[model samples]
Target: MPDHASESSVRPETPEPTGTSKPSRATESKPEGEPTERPESSEAPGMSEAPEFRDAVPSPPQVPAYAQQGRQPQPPNPWQSNRQTTGTLARLRPARPAAIRNATLWAAVATALLSALLLGDGLGPNLLIVAVPAALAAYFAAQAAGRRLRTWSAVWAVGGLALLAVPALRDAGWPTFLAVVSAVALGSLTLHGSRSWLGVFLGSVGLLSSVAGGLRWGMGGVRDRMTGSRGRWGVVFRSTVVAIGLLIVFGALFASADAAFADVLGNLIPDVSLGDAPWRIFLFAVGLVGALTAAYTAAAPVRWDDITIRAGKPRGRLEWALPLIVLNLLFAVFIAIQLTVLLGGYDKVMAETHLSYSAYARQGFWQLLWATLLTLLVIALALRWAPRGQSRDRTLVRTVLGALCLLTLVVVASALRRMGLYVDAYGLTRLRISVAAIELWLGVVLILIMAAGMFGARILPRAVAASAAATVLAFGLVSPDGLIAEQNVQRYRSRHTIDIDYLRGLSADAVPALDSLPEPLRSCALKEIQQTLRTSDAPWYATSWGEVRARDILEKRSANALVANCRGQGSEGGSGRNGVEGDDSYDPY
Candidate 1:
């Protein structure tokens, strides 16, 4: 054999010439892909590990037979150790840890300041109340979001806030303001790459997350050095609580001893008014705490992307087309019947149903409203699994689905007409007006969905959401209360079956509409309105533009009938929103 020999491809139990070899221990220690000795006949001198043509790649970490995979070390925490600000145990890790920490710190500060401002006099004259608080929340949220998500959210937040800030929006009444608030609520999903529904959900939860800031503060501040564990500053907390108790007791004692001493400690003592009052200072403290926590929750959002994304095999083309075809046919028949009814009008409805106009209108309106709501779900599912390929199946599914949306919109129109007829007979109420608004909103959403389907837009849900939000803005601008009142008052002028009791129950928003009434009807309406204004027990914060307008109406022209009608009637706590003569009007608050 040569003096310098290549590593062997074979191993023998015993040496050939010396009749001796090491035990099998050294052979067993070599790992996978290592140059191990194998007993073979046709292998080349240098190709000891495997054949020359076999591909090479790194394998899993080499582990000893005695070592367990479970015992491997974990990765380090992404966030650097911070002694101040924010939760150390992050609810969700941000893409950039440093940016998140800074953002959270700033957000907490902003939230505290907001809490201070709100708890003092509170925010408003409308949107200005929520502006800085909202911006702070948006800013903190933007820190963790990508540029695209932040940008989209910014557009919505700005638009929604600006819409709320309009003076007319306040005058429009609560429904209009609430409608707009719902639209803004959608902006809570301002985090980029999040689903719109998820945003809506988080936005809602964000409203109640006020205590999260305190939790975060506690988390970041509490840590053990020697034991390497987290610990709270409980001793200091208990001591502070005890000290406050002592101060309260001693201050009470000192106050009883001297008037000058009592006066001196006035600034030091807090009058929470733990007495017979319905509300006091501590109530505001609780509210501020909740607001702060909610701000923190918004700022440090836990992404629900993994849970929000539905996982399953989307229905195949055949599966999609089959149900959609059947559904479209049903809708077509319904539409056909609806079309016939539309041309027939009120006379046909009475002849066929043999019911009063209001009864006839009431029965189907509720069902159709439900149908409209249900159809939205059906349309959502069809879009979710709609085939995208340029094939007959995709075309068929799209066409059928679009037809379905159009038909549902027809259903919406029918529902609106029914409600309109009902309202024409009964006059306007809040519930009737709200239902009408919802139906119109549904129709608008269907239209958006149809447009999205035509263009094969992936953002179908978002587009629908945006459209719904826009409709709310539009509804607010038009003002639902004023519209209801105007339409009802006009109906009374034309039909002359005005519900005097119903008009009595109308809110301040309806005052302008009722103001146009003539003589006896005008006196009756003014009487109830005047009583409501004079005896209303709503708090200062609850004061509204409607109240102001109602007050103005009452001041400008006194109603002698109202004074006489309510002469003996007491303004009891049972009066609810209005206290004038038991609020006999049929108007629902």
Candidate 2:
């Protein structure tokens, strides 16, 4: 067969792209290894008999340039267009009924899931609220992809399911971050057969793909089908319009006629402003389209790199290291101060700093936390793209970096110790617990990265990702509230000073732990739990298993005399607010 691509031949079906010059036939190159033309076949052109071959079907006669000019080129196929216009979607779209129904259904499902996640049980707002919907919309959007997307889609789906499985643990801050990262990783793997850093970034972009996907889904054959059915729809549309107008007219008349009937009718059919309908319709249309778009894009993501244009070469190691070196020295000085303070213990800090234990503990923790995170990013960028193979003094740079990372661990430990001391003193809040968990996770990742750096570049990223995920997962497995409650209760038992107000503010996750407190404290805690449970907006269908379990604890308590005892005392300010001067109330912060 002739190498058509290599030859300067143009076929009737394959026109050159617009604006590109056509290859001249005279300048065409002959295929390699072909016998020389035998001195023009020992005959003049057109005068001698033509040579014929049996096996030449693959190599069609090349249309001459003159003949091509006489015969107009066929138009481009919409399906094969490189530019992704709506026609591309029209070509690849599924059946109209299937697309419309499935898109609508999945869109509703996505909205419902959002509602459930938002209004149902939760551990404050985090990544799942955003990511799960994207995953879901992607799941159903890829429904058209069928078996092609089965594995990756399933993995993405499972990751989302895992995220929603434990509501109480959702606030395990590091675990939540890891779970989101895992979901993004899984999404990229499914969408693009990638697990690299680029893949994760693309997965994030894919979340917004739904908007375009929805457009694609709508622009798909559905629009054509709708246009095709417009003749029939026109009559139906006019008739419906007339009917609506008449209904409004008669409804107003009837309402004016019978007040009671109008009241019943009004109850059954709430009034809607025609003025706002367009905006509502617009929003609704956008949501449906966006949902389907997200799904479609997630299922069949466009090549992200094709659109992305990175700017320039990374800064050299020396450029990065010089600044990093300065920071490392500063950190070294800080570490020296920290070690001295550690040796001196709380007493030395008190006398030297003239600050109380809590003040000393809380003093630099937040600043150190930010410093640790910033340093991690700095180290990551420094190690990741800093011309390692080309640099002559890279080993020395790495050793210096390794020492810096090791010193940073002491900073992490200091932060952890400081936070722990503060928590022990002030009792725990959701925010405090989240910070603690994140710091611990950061510490683990630092260790992983430091160790991985020693081995080689190949090991570092994978180890960091894996270790970070594992650390988060481990943290998520333990109910933070339960732990917080246990610690606080222990502190209270030992010191006899519990923060009743703070404990009262905790969510249902703390109920079981708080329940273990002695009578009056337990009663007061149960009242708070019962009130939170009673006032919950989560529908039964949307309730997480953890929430259900929490509710059951409340229900069982209500069934016994426990609820009555609390309720009876609740009116007497069981909240421990109004204490008589001589009264021995169990009120303590």
Candidate 3:
């Protein structure tokens, strides 16, 4: 047979003097060394054109524009490109250096131990000690992991420490509670480069996410080491176990051998009984998780600002302006009425309403508070929907929102004035003072909004947050319970009325103020606080400054005399009241 492979590979020559009479221009335009088509019938049986003889050929790869211009193609940025794959999970999965891992582990252990020792007592000076050290440890761990602390991180960390001092300084429940919340919020913002309201919210969420992610990352590292390497880690683990066993054995023998050594050991180590073991373990776990979360976040903070939320669709000038204008007019009318009431017309209005001053104040204050809150919400929504792209739109937004904010300030003032009147009639309570403080804060926030409007809103969210933190700090520093006691005592001196039961409910921070009351009343006021102080056997480390001062004050007084007078007052049902009937509207929150 003929050589079919060679025949198939070679292109068949065109016959001279083709039927077309002359070669077509299209065929003439074909490039040299290109393959020519052949009929299948001309080939041998079961043979066809070879693969190389096919009409189509792959094209050469195109050169990039930069490469063609004598520049090398830049590598894609890992941070800015391929967001889908390079997300939080991918970032968290990188192998940490052994040194960094060990440092993080040590920091977590230290935090856990500190928390277990100091936290079980109560909220006190111990919180300050534990929190500051824990923050420092997290900072060091982050640095060990090659994460540089940013300026805002330092600011937030310092702010958190300052807020944590509230518990050490004030024993008032609400102030301490608010301070802890503010501190935790600031802590979350430490690593996350948050600069907006959305960023703040996501930073909080990221804190929780870091907790679980850090646990998984840490456990994975441990699992890998346990399964992969039996050389160094195994010996280290075995040595640790041996050391622990030796310590337990030697410690017990030595404690049994000497009384002074036993006392020292008992004092040095926390007494973890079987019943308290679970609680202590829980506290330790919290500390470990908290520390690991902070370190993990610091090492790889999610760029939450990258997640952009599109603004609300802009409304037409008419659509946006009409409601706000109507609302502004309504506010103007309300302010007019409020101003009239603030003037000498308050008595006439009260008489027309058939309510006393306190009664009238009570009826209106809560409504005004709710109105103030709702107005803030409305302002937020208005700004969201406000028209912007045009000069006219900008002016409209500034004018309308500005007026709304200004009117809201007046509402805030009205709420505060109403609360003041209510307090004057009934004496101050924790709830009254707290609400007043909140109203004052709202007023400050409205002022911030107006300022932001005048200048710019870029810093408004952070400014608002700082203001809130400052308000809480100031509120704590003022010692709300002490102030309440002092005000009520003064009210009693002037009006000959006070709420003894309410005063008794205050914390030890009120001791100095309550101690100034006349005999039986003083005894009744100090009765509960004294009981708390007497019963509390908290160690010196857990005692707050407020608690220490209260103890000192009580020590100088006659407990026996106070107890005797308190018993007589209790027998006579001497729980003083402001003589006004209790109204259901009086909520002390």
Candidate 4:
């Protein structure tokens, strides 16, 4: 051992033996993956005694334990995140925040401008046509800039355009214009990928227009959506043949019983109000639309024929029972009508000479026929096109109700005309307008009840019952002959006696109310007031009635009211009394 130690000391002390020996506590205190410790002489003066351990081999500050475990600190995100970062972030983050903020600010400015324009009077109507388009362009631009782009603005814009287009749709070249638009819309649906919204918009437009056109065509040229595949020629030819056959049958019946059926169809079909040339043009346009719809429904890309078409003939009990039930109902209706006519019911129920029970009965026959055909067409279409097991009962019920409404309208029209109110062809009378106002109120209630029914079906039994109740309430409350109705001048004159002198001294608000009273009553009231105002001989007050009346006129806020009074020259009030003897047609002003 002495000889080996002497050799080791002389042989340049082998580094392998020194390294393999256990390190001292001071050297072991440093961690692995660090540089070897330096000599004590290199240390600063009194470093060990100064209570400071200045590290010669320093490592970066150690990460906290929580951070190492990933329990507190987290990886950095390119987007916003509550995390620590050890690397660079995404470049897009900075720009996106500013872009979103700017886009939102622009949207706010546009909305405010739009609101201001709409609130103004002349600007609103003049700009209304272009307002929707301008608004839509701004909305779309902003939406694309925003995080999520909603496509609903596009739908609204198209709807607004349709409303504006209605008045201009009856032009001489309108048919060609419509056809072009329809074709464009239909073709747009074929677009793929990013252009899909364009297709949806165009298709929706075409569909809405088609619905309106179909209604204007009435029942004669209605299309079968499910059977559109057979082509236009086949459908048109079939319709023509049916129309001819019916006309021939009608002619033969008329020849046999001219007296009975002469007046039946006379009123149902109105004469050409716009002259023959225009009427023919109208018919041709209507026919074109009908033909186009039929062709499209028959052969559209979306196959609807498969569901409707049945390869085999029906052999079920339904076929037999349905015809029998229909026959029984027709027979029952005929019997009821005959019985009523024999019991002097016509005399009792008839309201006007123009529109009578006999007229309604005549109209009902054709209406019922048209309605049945329409319902059958809807049923056939639904059966063929709808998914299996989806019933057409709802549609059929709706059609039946529509027929009832038509008949009810005619009956109500006659009743109104009998009460001395002027009614137009579509039953648009002052009484009807009054009823409509009341009906509008009832409609609000109907909506509430319908909403409640969605939650629990027991809220309302049937919509029909509500409709009938509404009609009855309207008839009872708003009818020209109703107990409290102000339609009759005589009733008003008999009820309230207007003090002419007192009214003449009142303000413009009270003067305008005279117009609200029945015409004859207004005439009498104004007459007495004028006599009091114009004459000073028997007057209670000592003032020029004209000066007093002019003062009353100046108090009016309405420009029209002011103009009407100014035109009256304060003598028109007396004219209501002395303009004519007992005639009620004098100016009520």
List the global CA lDDT of all models: 0.58, 0.59, 0.77, 0.36
- The residue-level lDDT of candidate 3 at 135 comes to 74
In order of appearance, the predictions have TM-scores of: 0.63, 0.59, 0.78, 0.24
Worst 10 residues of 1 by lDDT: 577-586
Deviating ranges (above 4 Å) for candidate 1: 1-127, 137-149, 162-184, 191-193, 196-214, 218-299, 308-319, 345-349, 384-390, 535-543, 561-589
On the 0 to 100 scale, the lDDT of residue 298 in model 3 is 72
Model 3 spans with C-alpha error above 4 angstroms: 1-48, 51-99, 144-146, 223-269, 561-576, 581-589
lDDT of 2: 0.59
Q: List clashing residue pairs in candidate 2.
A: 210-293, 210-294, 213-293, 214-293, 499-589
Give candidate 2 regions above 4 Å deviation: 1-157, 168-199, 218-291, 305-329, 384-392, 455-476, 536-538, 558-589
How much is 412 displaced in model 1, in angstroms? Answer: 1.5
Per-residue error for 69 in candidate 3, Å, reads 28
Backbone clashes in each candidate structure, one number apiece?
12, 5, 0, 3
2 or 4, greater by lDDT:
2
Per-candidate RMSD, Å: 12.4, 16.5, 9.1, 26.9
Candidate 3 structure quality by residue, lDDT tens digits, 437-475: 888999999999999999999988877877887888888
| lDDT of candidate 2 over 1-589, digit per residue (tens) | 3777646465446654543354456335756676434343244447444443211123445687867789766678877857766643344333342454445454544554354333323343323454455556656656665526555345555554564444434323344455655645544545543334544456544545446545766566456655778787588669989998999899989999999989877754433457656654554565455455555555556544343335345566677678778888998899888887777666866897788665577667887889889988877667555555555557756776788788889899999888877776656666777787778878887787777666755545434545544554555667766677777787767655565556666655676677777767676765766766678654333344445667777776652335444423322323333111123233232
Check candidate 4 and list the clashing pairs: 228-298, 229-298, 308-384
Question: Residue 351's C-alpha lDDT in candidate 2?
Answer: 92
- On a 0 to 100 scale, what is the lDDT of residue 253 in model 1? 99
For candidate 4, lDDT tens digit of each residue in 1-589? 9999998778884344321345579788988889775555445655644323333434456679998877877676768866756331122112221121223223333433433322222111223333343343334433443423325323333433433332222111222233334333422221110122223443334333333422332232233322444576578669989997998688668846885565655433323334454544544444334333322221222211122324334333344235434644554575466456445665654554445443554344344334434433443333333222224543343343333333333333333332222222111223344444443433443344334433543423223333333343333222222112222222234423222222333322233444455444344334434443344221111122222443354334212312223222212234432112233313221
Q: In angstroms, how far off is 211's CA in candidate 2?
A: 1.2
